[model samples]
Target: MRTLEALATGTPLVASDYGLEGLSVDSPGTPLGAMRANDVDEYVYAVGRLFQDEKLQEKLSNNGRALIENEYAWEQMTQRYEQVLLDTCSKYLVESQE
Candidate 1:
């Protein structure tokens, strides 16, 4: 979920609308950006676009790596879980909150 959010915040995505279904962001595509890869062909097309186009590669590289750094990174993800637990306990005031 966090990765998706990060990706959305960055470059275009090649994912199914169903893949995007039940998510927060409404618009995930742009005129020359984010696309849906519901099948092998769409995926190949999107990837081809990335490779054949230098700008696309730059976009994917920058955005995808940023996603990894910001969300998929082990330390960052761990922090999210830790914060969730702390927030839950703080809200409920449980003895185990410590």
Candidate 2:
């Protein structure tokens, strides 16, 4: 949730891969400039890199914000949830009638 907030606010991110499983932020073909930190050392290194590289920080910040705006905005996420709830309720209603 905090990550979403950060992304929404255009903050550059360095997060754990496990925390970003479905988003594919650090995976192959990831569109965002986010870096993944697997451990403490990597986390430190990633933070240092961001601090040292202004261009990289800017790229990551922009990409993170764009990604959220495109795919994970509150309105989009809520619509998806509403669809899931409606679908599940419809399915159960049909099954119960049988």
Candidate 3:
């Protein structure tokens, strides 16, 4: 949720690589490619990169904001959850009939 907030606000971010089971990083079309840090050195490097490169920062900020607005909005998330529940129930019903 913190990441979502930062993305929504167009903040370039550096974050730990752990605990992001559902969050995607390091994708070709994603702004989080270089922002996932596995250690202190990687974290420092990521922050330094953001600090030194204004163009990169701007690109990440724009992409992050767009990603959140398009994919992570509250309505979109709720729809996805509802779809998952419906699919799960359908599968369970089908299996039980066999």
Candidate 4:
């Protein structure tokens, strides 16, 4: 939830792999919204890189915000959940009729 909040607020992130678990931020062939850093040294390097690179910061900020707006927003999540429920109900109805 904190990660979603940060993304919603357009904050650039340097997060651990564990921190990003279960999120869609690591899709293949796509830029990540946050830099993944597992250890102290990796965290330090990622933070330093984030601080020093303006373009990277902008990219991360935009990607993160877009991710939240597209996938994690209340409206979006509600729609997805509603669709899942509808699909499940439809499947159950069809199976019962069989």
Better of 1 and 2 by TM-score: 2
Off by over 4 Å in 2: none
- TM-score computed on alpha carbons, candidate 3: 0.77
The worst-scoring run of ten residues by lDDT in candidate 2 lies at 19-28
lDDT of each: 0.63, 0.85, 0.77, 0.87
The candidates, ranked best first by TM-score, are 2, 4, 3, 1
lDDT of 1 at 3: 35
Go through the candidates in order and give the clash count of each.
2, 0, 0, 0
Task: Rank candidates, lDDT, best first.
Answer: 4, 2, 3, 1
Question: Which RMSD values do the candidates have, in order?
Answer: 6.3, 1.7, 2.4, 1.8
The residue ranges of model 4 lying beyond 4 angstroms of the native Cα positions read 95-98
**Per-model TM-score versus the true fold:** 0.52, 0.84, 0.77, 0.84
lDDT of 3 by residue, 2-94 (tens): 877887898886777553445665567655523778798988888898889999898778877887888889899999999999999999999
**Stronger candidate by lDDT (1 vs 3):** 3
Error of 4 at 44 (Å): 0.4
Which portions of model 3 miss their true places by more than 4 Å? 29-34, 95-98
Pairs of residues clashing in candidate 4: none
* Tens digits of per-residue lDDT for model 1, 60-92: 656555645654668987999999999987888
